[model samples]
Target: MKTVLKYLPALTLAAGLALSAIPAMAQQPAAKAGAAPAQPKSSPAAIAAAKEILSMKNASAMYANAVPGMVEKTKIALIQQNLNYQKDLNEVAQVVAQQLNGRQNEITEGMAQVYASEFTEQELKDLVAFYKSPLGQKLITAEPKAIGLSMAFMNSWAQNFTETVMGAFRAEMRKRGKEI
Candidate 1:
């Protein structure tokens, strides 16, 4: 518990940094004034696929599960402590969300630049509409969970892969009478 508490701030900071680094669609520059926004040429199937992929139920559930662990690790004692804990967590979450949203905007803007030549204005409008729907809203709201899960999965995989590669390297070095 104490160890978890000791690392909480570091972990939170790392998470914030990681979230802020993601590329989003909104970060791209707009076209010349009076020029139309470029949109992706997407079919109904494609739109449906995007909507399905962005489901927030799973993300919300995962967030609900993980938040309690974080709160517990923080070790708040009373109503005031709990309130403070909530406030701090909410503040940090908002910051991370903004960073991630900025990144998303950047990516979208870049995509717009690329697909501008390929897609029509209406297609872009449709894509934006889909993104602004209730489902889209849910996905945006639940982004933190998705980010957290992805980070955890990647970190675990990288750790295991590094250990395996390093272990093999050390073993080979030892066999060759070299310092590992």
Candidate 2:
């Protein structure tokens, strides 16, 4: 469960990227430390188009549980810091979750901002048009399953490789008169 929790943000980001032309957009090299490029200024039209594309992909649904999960994580951390406040922390978590309900749209909006900044208004318009087409619609339906299968395969491969690496480590350590 803890592992699953830790990977939730990655999964959410992956899901969003999987739904967009992120691979192409990611071609540029990352910036050096403290030298990140500024986000391009997005026009309202560009933002709107980005929002439409995101809506077609149902992006907000991916983060539907985020608010509640964050509240719970914070509550647990607070409880850990002051065990005597566990009950109050739990109550506060519920209140915070309630207050933040439906705020998952914030994630959707932020993603739209990223898309809008990365692509021109015309490009975003083109994306919306593409999503409206039959082939694009088919991709929208198929991509999630493809991503699921890919993740499963990668997990299986990594698990099998883990033992191989562990054995190699042990062998190398034994040769050095040290056991690991």
Candidate 3:
């Protein structure tokens, strides 16, 4: 238990760094204009905002927020506390996985909406071309794994950290004859 606790922070940080690195793949490059310099289809500001909102960071944060409720739900379904910990953990993992999958869908859908509003058909074609390149495909593959690993690491870290902190606090309260 202590060994796991000791390495939790390192694992969490590594997972976070890995996840943070995954999303650069899908980022659209600067739009190139053809001979006519096609009147810059989308406002640069709107494009920037859409990119920011649809970014991996934003998606990961949303996933992170959804995980605790999942964990709690698992805990509440106790059959036998000791025997069920692993089972509960597995269930929570599934929940997080599903949430990440949904988030990726959301990001894709949001991008489609933005493209519809911001770009003409030709400009959308140009954007799709860039995303279909090798770099774009790599990003698409990596982002989900990054998200999953990061969430798993953080969930473990949070559970352990909460246990540690709450254990100490409860001990202190017990010493003071206070009900926790």
Candidate 3 wrong stretches, greater than 4 Å? 1-111, 115-130
Give the Å error, residue 52, model 1.
21
Error of 3 at 103 (Å): 20
TM-score of each: 0.35, 0.77, 0.33
Highest TM-score: give the candidate number. Answer: 2
Candidate 2, 1-180: lDDT as tens digits: 345444544564477566555665587677788996788789999999999987887776667788898888888889999999888888888889999898877888898898887788998899899989999899777766665666767788899999999999999999999999
Candidate order, lDDT descending: 2, 3, 1
lDDT for model 1, on a 0 to 1 scale?
A: 0.50
Lowest-scoring 10 consecutive residues by lDDT in candidate 1? 53-62
Highest lDDT scorer: 2
For all candidates in order, the CA lDDT equals 0.50, 0.80, 0.53
Quote the lDDT for 161 in model 3. Answer: 100
Clashes of 2: 0
lDDT of 3 at 172: 97
Off by over 4 Å in 1: 1-118
Q: TM-score of model 2 relative to the true fold?
A: 0.77
Candidate 2 clashes between residue pairs 3 or more apart in a chain or in different chains: none
